[model samples]
Target: MLHEIVISGFGGQGALFAGQLLAYGALEEGWHVTWIPSYGPEMRGGTANCTVIISDEEIGSPLTRHPTAAIVMNLPSYERFEPLIAPGGVLVVNASLIAQKSQRADIRIIYAPANDIAAELGAAQMANVVLVGAMLAATGALQFETLDQVLDKHISARHRDKLELNKRALRRGGALAV
Candidate 1:
């Protein structure tokens, strides 16, 4: 299986971190993977996006013009990547920030109230993690176990106290898929 995924949101929204986690999980699974991140100079409020490709076989290229899945955490990201998603591909939308709907009918769209969901879990800024779960749930691209492992290994030791919140955020977001 091959999954070309694009994750986009504002710079502080952790879009790059989400891509890293996906790459880490795929790497742990022994799948071929690549992660590329891009952002504007303004940082925080500026746009940030990342592309993650996971495949059973070697990837021919890192460039993805049309991805198999897209995780949009804001209205701008949604507007930007919605048209770039492949037909029948999974599109995880952050309904918490985006009130507009995608015009494309060819894609499978999943609305993830990331901010709301994270707030409910008491970590309002962890909406990225929420969208991660929704992406996994909607696309069946990765397992929560792997996501947990990635967090365990990648998240700095000093910030380990928040591990449980991240785990909960992922599980909660995954639950939204059902």
Candidate 2:
């Protein structure tokens, strides 16, 4: 199985972090994985994106011209990546930030109000976590337990207090996926 995905949004939205988590999770499952992050000059509010590929076989290259799926957190991300999703692929949309509806009919679309859900969870900065959860639910790309383990690896002593919140946020996003 091969899964090529792009996650995009503003820098502070945690797009890169989400991709990192997915990469870690896939690696834990013994899958070959690659994660490449990109961001503009301005850090926080600037455009941020990451490409992640998970495969069971040897990976020839990391670049994904047409990804299997896209996790988008804003309208700009949607506009940029929507056309790049493979036919019959999946698109996870953050309805809280994006106003335009997807025009593509060849792929599966899942909408979650990531920002709103994260805000409700009292971890507004975890909007990307919410989308990650939704992607987990929609794609079943990685097991929940795998993600839980990956989450533990990503958390540091300074942010241990947020472990539960991130876990909850991921579950909340999974619920929102459907």
Candidate 3:
């Protein structure tokens, strides 16, 4: 199996981190994975994105012109990546940040209120994790349990205190996948 995913948003929105989590989960599942991050020079508040490719076999490259799935955390990301998803692919959009609706009919779209859900969960920064959860539910590219385990094993020491909160956000986002 193979899955190419893109997670995008402004810098500091955790797009790269979310992609890292997915890459970690893929690795935990014994899959060949590659994560490539790109950001504008402005850093925070500037455009940022990451591409993650997970495969059961060796991967030739880390880039994809049309990703099989995408998590867009802001309007700009939605605008940039929505048209790039492969036909019949899955897309998880941050409804709280994007005011416009998608017009595409070929791909499955999940309009998750990630920011609002994370805020409600007490950490708006976790909006990226929330979208990651939604992507898991919608695409099944990786097991949700794998993500939970990744959180436990790979979360940074500084954010260890919010592990439970992150899990809660994941579950909440997953629940919205339907």
Candidate 4:
């Protein structure tokens, strides 16, 4: 199977980090993965997006023109990439940040209040993780255990204290997906 996902939001929202975690989880599953992030000109407080591809076979391109899924963390991202999702693809949108929805009928859209959920979990910064959880629930691209392992492996020592909160967000998101 091949899964291509794009995660996009304003800078500092951990959009790129979420993509990295997804790629890492796919890698642990023994899949070939690639992650490519694009930053806006201003860097801070600007739009940022990352493309992650996970495939069981050789991956020819890191860039995805039409992704199988998307995690839109902001309105701008939804506006920009909504048209790019393939038919029958899945989209997980952060309803706390994005106010609009995609008009397409061919895709499955999941509205997750990720930021609000993370904030309630006392780790507002882990909104990305919440979205990731929702995506896993919606698409089953990787197992929840895979995500947990990725978090354990990728979270820095400095952020160790916030692990519980992130886990909580992930659980909440997964619940919503169900």
* lDDT leader: 3
Estimate the overall C-alpha local distance difference test score of candidate 3.
0.93
| Clashes found in each candidate (C-alpha, N, C closer than 3 A) | 0, 0, 0, 0
Candidate 4 residues lying further than 4 Å off, grouped into runs, are: 39-42
TM-score of each: 0.95, 0.95, 0.97, 0.96
lDDT by residue (tens digit), candidate 2, 1-178:
8899999998788898899999999989999999998745849888899999999898877879898989999888999999999998889999998978888999888888988888998878888888889888888788878888988888768768888888998999888766
Q: Which portions of model 2 miss their true places by more than 4 Å? A: 39-42
In candidate 1, what are the lDDT values of residues 36-112, reduced to their tens digit?
88755838889999999999999988769999999998888888899999988999999999998877899888888
Each prediction's Cα lDDT score?
Answer: 0.90, 0.88, 0.93, 0.89
Residues 1-178, candidate 4: write the lDDT tens digits: 9899999999889999999999899989999999999855837589999999999999999999899999998898998889999998999999997788667899999999998988888878988999999888988889988888888888989899987777778889989889
Model 3 TM-score, all chains together:
0.97
**Structure candidate 1, residue pairs in collision:** none
Assess candidate 4 and give its TM-score to the true structure. Answer: 0.96
Return model 1's CA RMSD, one decimal: 1.2
Find the 10 residues in a row with the least total lDDT in model 2: 37-46
Q: What are the RMSD figures for all models against the true structure? A: 1.2, 1.3, 1.0, 1.1
**Candidate 3: stretches off by over 4 Å:** none
| Candidate numbers sorted by lDDT from highest down | 3, 1, 4, 2
